[model samples]
Target: MSQQQTTLHVELGDRRYPIYVGASLLSASNLIAGAIKGRQVVVVTNETIAPLYLDTVLRQLPDTMLVTSVILPDGEQYKTWQTLGDLFDQVLAARHNRSTTFIALGGGVVGDITGFAAACYQRGVDFIQIPTTLLAQVDSSVGGKTAVNHPLGKNMIGAFYQPTAVVIDTSTLATLGEREYAAGLAEVVKYGLIYDPEFHRWICANRDLLAARDVDTLRHAIQRSCEIKAEVVAADERESGLRAILNLGHTFGHAIETHMGYGSWLHGEAVAAGMVMAVRLSAMRGSVDVDLVVELEQLLVDLGLPVWAPQDMTSATFIDLMALDKKVIDGQMRFVLLNALGSAVVVDDVTEAELTALIDG
Candidate 1:
């Protein structure tokens, strides 16, 4: 049975777009085809996903449309300028023009790189996100925060380009690897923590259902997560202030991804540990109770996520790498810390001593 589809919109004034969340949406030809502004479409995917759902998506487009598939190797390690340049090579070789619509057919890596390509291709073009992974569906694919990673930082080189639409097929989670699916849950937990305490509590109580990949449970989780993100993005499309709160654990998480090497620690795993750190720091500053740290750590553990930073990475290592984070402004470190569950604040007054104590302790 197909799950009921819920449609939400990211109201970006002139650029508002709809997000469709449900089961078997990849087969929704109308949803996919309607979003393309032109007859030219570029389906960008990776090896792993291409074998799984690429052909299925291709079958949706009408035979008359100019369709090209740019299949790249899969992995977070591959999100680089070198790979991006190569992607451009493929599109240009196909003679794709400004009318081309780039379709991202995999997880966050594919979505980020493909969106960046669309953003730069002919100065700008349309793109649709068919996020297969739970992580991409819940977080990365929704907000239009597109980018390729840099050696110095994660998402350092990117744009605030929105997708024409998002088609999330919940059934794809059935094919997702255990770790990847769990990593996605970290983002789900984040929504509850930073924006909705009741949602967080629901996630905790329903961990078993989520772990088992219950369709209805997963659908609710994805829809609610996207709704929160959409609300945040609509208010601050450029991350000027409010939207930055959406990056609850990203600063520390990005450092972990950079230091441990991209793909070594999945973005969501790093964020799990990073959230613990952020909450711990909040406790240190008396913004939130120290028990909130323990509560979050236990929840992550229950959700099969890492609750603490890697043992090999010292506090100094985190400090050094985090200094390079995109959130840093004018040499001041800003952290999104929770004053209470469901209430988050961005603070730049964190002293070095506080960081050392949080990480080293």
Candidate 2:
């Protein structure tokens, strides 16, 4: 690893894997080469990202290896069983086998679909995560929660298959659009809200630097976020208990994504709004002060994120969509709500009246 690079690992015992975060690490063929489990490699990415970083990644693999690149259309709408089937078709046509190591080289949409493909293809194959977006770098690419969306609910079908390694090159953020970059920050801010109060205050204090995309600020943010997630995943790999806290705003956010149609709102954008609603509900339960909700809303607004759900979405809409959420168990609905700033809990006792008030009020 270079002096500029930071490496952390997800401790899944024999299945443990490393996450590399740094500047220009994509050019480091050694890191990429070291993670491959076999001589055959398959790279899965989207059209938008393929043009940007695919070649650089391809260059890292030796010519002696069988490297096939499958590029799909970009967008959340493309994350479906059909796209996944198309990817399998291309890989099979190229004669890839169980020995192939798949690499995911894009943002969340690309990463999730690719990871899920790796999990199911040939009964599971080793895959590396080359997450190019901030959201993927800090969140999705780390945990083993791989899946594609369904019309009724988000990430409804998937597996707990982990990656062999994760490579996050900070330089890719330079090419990201403003909206996408801000969307990623929503996840970064979520780390502070759920696990670290000091980090939360630091984020609020350094909003300008974060907005400016200062190199050091971003590195620290990505590294710390990964560390928190790593610790959590190490403790609860399958989200059986402790890990559910990671979805602090995701329950409400997923409902929004499904109701609005996939791709209508970025995942992080919906989560930003959802976090506020969760915090508002926490205040209603008297677990956290109402003032904290205002502070979080202000911070999200300052970071150029939405702090409210869509104008047309109603309590009825949210209830209907969220009822289909994957987190629901045995006819009971579970939600991750803040018990306090930097503390989150999963509760199943939230009454329908409370939810209606939280949404309609």
lDDT tens digits by residue: candidate 1, 221-318: 99999999999999999999999998899889988889899989999999999888888888888888888888888888988999888888887898
- Tens-digit lDDT track for model 2 on 1-361? 3459998999999999999999889886489988987899999998899889998999999899999999999999999989999999999999999999999999999899999999999999999999999999999999898998777677888999999999989999999998899999999999999999999999999999998899999999999999999999999998899999999888899988887889889999999999999999999999999999999999998889999999788888888888888888987889988888899999999888999899887
User: What ranges in model 1 sit over 4 Å off?
Assistant: none
The local lDDT score (0 to 100) that residue 320 gets in candidate 1 is 90
Stretches off by above 4 angstroms in model 2 are: 1-3
lDDT of 2: 0.92
Provide the RMSD of all predictions against the true structure, rounded to 1 decimal. 1.0, 1.1
- Where does the lowest 10-residue lDDT sum fall in candidate 1? 25-34
The lDDT of each candidate is 0.92, 0.92
lDDT of 1: 0.92
Model 1 lDDT, residue 257, Cα = 87
